[model samples]
Target: MATLPYWRLSGFYLFYFALLGATAPFLALYFHHLGFSSARIGELVAIPMLMRCVAPNLWGWLADYTGQRLLIVRVGALCTLFSFALIFVSKSYAWLALVMALHAFFWHAVLPQFEVITFAHLREQPERYSQIRLWGSVGFILTVVILGRVFEGLSLDVYPVTLVVVMAAIVLCSLWVPNAQPSSGNRKVLADGFFKQLRSPGVLAFYACVALMQMSHGPYYTFLTLHLESLGYSRGMIGLLWALGVVAEVLMFMAMRRILLRFSVRRVLLFSFLTAGVRWLLLGSFAEHFWLLLLAQLMHAATFGSFHAAAMTFVQRSFGPGQQGQGQALYATLAGVGGAAGALYAGYAWNTLGPTITFSMASVAALAAAVIIATRLQEDRP
Candidate 1:
């Protein structure tokens, strides 16, 4: 039996999500600082997500074929750092778009493979998955909270430097994590007919639902800070609001085992979609109310926290061991597609439809996802 390198795994997630922390709250703000229109900002931001649709699946296939996941992770992390470094050369929309495309192509490849590696280490104890994964929430909170103040004190031009530091950390952590072996003899069986399992109705519905869930997050990820700024909130407050949502996510991760024990994954997923719908509706209707906004942020416990936990477990169980990388990659792919669509629409809608209508569309997406899961997905009980 292998001892789980608890902190090693945790450290990787911490640094990895820390990069997200920097991007999610401030990247759009950075582009805004450059005086780009909302649509251009959306296009810039969407570059990475658009790459996610193809990058992870291609990398996952290679990892499965070669069984060298850690090697792939390290190379991907290193390339991401190099690509992102190009931002210093030029800040033009064309230049930044090129950099974002290259950076995200490599960066997005790191996570889904690492997810399989994490579960590989956990082996028979999948319940411990969230405990290990919660460090990512911790990483996000620290970055959002600190960078919030940092941006307030300094200029948004400093954002890229901060991201570079985090990217370096990711590269270092990738080097530190050891390669995990595939499950015993499961690879051969899994390799034989992986795509056959992918054709199931439940699997199809689950990916569709996953896409919608991520699509609904577009406005939040792409423009929440700007929206709050428009509503008279400080930069620090916007950061705290972002941290608050992840704090809710952290708490949910801590209690995920208990939650899973009591409810079926289908039940949990249905609840997550419904709660996400409410969250979007509240944000669209009452974003000017700080208290209401806080309440809506708390729904992150379900929107991302429970939804992600349930969805990851569902993917793990749905496929055999050899196919886990692809399972996780498929999740990333659909999420990329959804996120890209959401960000694109949110960009166009932010100026024309306004935040209320923009986010209302997100609410409708989540509700529609709920309908899909309720009708098409079955409870995965073993």
Candidate 2:
């Protein structure tokens, strides 16, 4: 712990997720303020996710082949900043869509490669990952709370500028992070071994569950703000609700080392999926009830915090050193596929089937993931 470049690695995650905090809850609202319909907002938001499908794989392969993950991270961050700045130039649907795709292409390239760098730095101390990662939740909480208040007092016009500032912070942090490499001796063997391992039944099942888990989040990420706002909650309150979820997540992260030490990763994942299923159902059915909505928000600890931590550990253990970049990239790719699908479906459903049915659909997706993990994913030590 004393020897690790802990602050550098943690700082990158802080700003990276801070960018997420700014966009995830507010981007759609900004689009709505521009008078776009639900369908258009969905399409615009999905554009970046669609880019995730292609960008991460391409960048990951390049990072693996060249062994310059940190260099790629820096370049990707700079490009993301420039591309996203184009949002200031236009409010046309086509223009915003293009900006989303362009910025996300580079933005998506940063994290998978950076994950490889962090793990390399951790080396033998992977369990400490959550301690470092918890700062990201803090960054998220700060942005969500502050911006929520800002938006309450100001216009949505400030949204783009706020994002640009966060992106700039990400660029600065990317430059500050030191590079690290995984083992190189088995490069050829590990490189060739990636596909072979990916083909195994357990790995295939796990990836499928990954897609489903993210797909289940579509309604929440794409419309929760709007949904709560319709119910008359203030922007300041909505932001706090979002922050509360991440606060639970931070607490979960603080306890994850102890939890992982006592339980299998498979168990943690199963629990996460189960809780997600329940959370979505509650949100769909009883969102008007403050206590129920609060309970659902708290379940974010299981849905994102535990699920992500366990999945990261699983990926790290499943792939070899040479395959780390590709492994993380593939994970991001699946998440992108699921998220895109979710946003598109939620957008169409939010108006047609209504919020209850739309959220129920999300619940079903989560339950299906729970089933997959229960019946298919084999038990593994954490």
Candidate 3:
């Protein structure tokens, strides 16, 4: 039996999501600080997401074919760092857009492959995944809380430097993590190919639901900080709000092993989608009410935490060991498609439809996902 390199795996997630902690909440604000319009900001922010649709598949294929997931992660991390360093060179809209595209191409390549590596490490003890993954939530919380304070006192100019530091940490952690191939003995060899498995019962619907769930997040990711700023909230408060969501996510992750044991992944996914619908509605309609906003943020536990763990389990079980890389990659790809579409539409709709309507649209997207899951996704034991 292999001893889980538990802390090392957890360390990689820490830095990997620390980079997200820096980017997800602040990157748009950074673009705003640069004087870009909402539409342009959406486009810039969506660039990486757009790259997610492409890069992950390419890198996933390479990893699966070569059995070199860790090397891909290291190369992706290094390239991400180098590409993002170009941000300091120019603030022009075109330059920033190009930089976003370049860095995100590499950045998107890291996670899905790393996810495969992480699970490969976990092997038989798949339930322990969230225990290790919760460290990522911890990383997100630390950065958001600290940087929230940091930005309050300093200029947003520090944002890029902060991201670069986190990216460097990711590179270091990638080098530290050991590679794990999916054990040949444990693999379920399917007679059908990757696409056939993808078309298997409930699989396609699940993927579509994944895309819709991400699509619903567009306004929250792209504009929630700006929205709060418009509502007279301080950057520190906004940071706390962002951290609040992940804090809930961390607690949820800690409980996920028991949760999964008690509930089917299908049930968990359905509940997640329904909770997301309500969460979006609250965010759209009641954001000015502090308690309501807090409740909405707390729903992140269901929306991302439980939903993600359940989704990973589903994907892992849906495909054979030979196809894990592509399975995870396709998951990322559809999510990218949905997220990119959401950002684009939110960018166009935000100024025209305003926050209430923009967020209501997000609510509708989430509910739509719920409906799909309730009706189309079948229960399966993992």
Candidate 4:
């Protein structure tokens, strides 16, 4: 039996998400510092997500064709580091947009391939994935909480420095973790072709719901910090609020084994969509109240934690061994498309319709996802 490189895998997730922790909460604020409008900020943030629509599938196919997933991850990590370094050269909107899109194209390629590698390592025990993935949440918490305080002392100008450090760490971790190919026997068990699996009603519904679920997160991902700041929340407090959500996610991941054993993936996903709708409604309606905001943040357990674990499981079970790369890639693609749409719409709506209506739109998107899951998603038997 091969030893699971638990810490290595965990370390990569830690640094990768630490990068996200630094960027997602503060990037909009950084754009605000540069005096960009909400629409432009939305476009800037949406660039990487738009890249996700195409980058993952392209890279995923190459990985599957070549069987060099880890190599792809390494090259991607390096490319992301170099591309993002260009941000320091120009602060122009066009330049920044191009850099973000370029960096994201490579950055987005890393995760889906890494996910396939991780699943390859886990082999038969897919449930243990949450255990390994929880480190990412811990990283998110640490970065958000610490950076929240750091940004309070410093300005958003320090944001790029923090991101660069985390990105470098990702490259180092990618180098440290060697690849593990699935056994030939496992690969031989490819029962369904990728396209055939994708053609299933359940598969189609699941992907649609996945897209909508992420779409619902657009405002939160793109502008939650700015929204809270407008409500008189300090940077540190906003970071804590962001950390609070991931803390809930970490706890949920810790308990995911029990959750999975008790509930069907379809059921968990349905509940996630419903909770997301409610969470968005509360966020839009009562963000000024600390308790309500905290309560809303707690919903991250359902919205992302359980939803993601369930979605991964659905993809794993739906696609055969040879198809894992494409399955994960497809998931990333739809998520990217949905996220881009969400960010674009949120950007347009934020200035004109304001935060309340913008978030209400997120709520409607979540509700729509719930309906799709409820009506069209079928439970696959173990």
Model 3: residues with Cα > 4 Å off, grouped in runs: 184-192
lDDT of 3 at 275: 98
Model 4 stretches with alpha carbons more than 4 Å out? 183-192
Clashing pairs in 1: none
- TM-scores, all candidates, are 0.98, 0.98, 0.97, 0.97
Q: Which 10 successive residues of model 3 have the least lDDT summed? A: 183-192
Worst 10 residues of 1 by lDDT: 184-193
The predicted structure with the larger TM-score, 2 or 3, is: 2
- Candidate 4: deviation at residue 255, Å? 0.8
Tens-place lDDT per residue, model 2, 177-243, is 8889998656677777999989866798898899999999999999999999999999999999999
Runs off by more than 4 Å, candidate 2:
186-188
- Give the residue spans of candidate 1 off by over 4 A: 184-192
Q: Lowest-scoring 10 consecutive residues by lDDT in candidate 2?
A: 183-192
Q: Give candidate 4's error at residue 221 in angstroms.
A: 0.7
For residues 182-295, could you state the per-residue lDDT of candidate 4 as single tens digits? 543334344247888889878998898888988999999998999999999999999999999999999999998888988898899989999999999899889999899999
1-382 per-residue lDDT for model 1 (tens digits): 8889999999999999999999999999999999999999999888899998999999998988788889989999999999999999999999999999999999988999999999999999887899989999999999999999998999888888999999999999988898795664555577665788888768899999999999999999999999999999999999999999999999999999898888899999999999999999999989898799999999999999999999999998888888888888989999999999999999999999999999999999999999999999987663
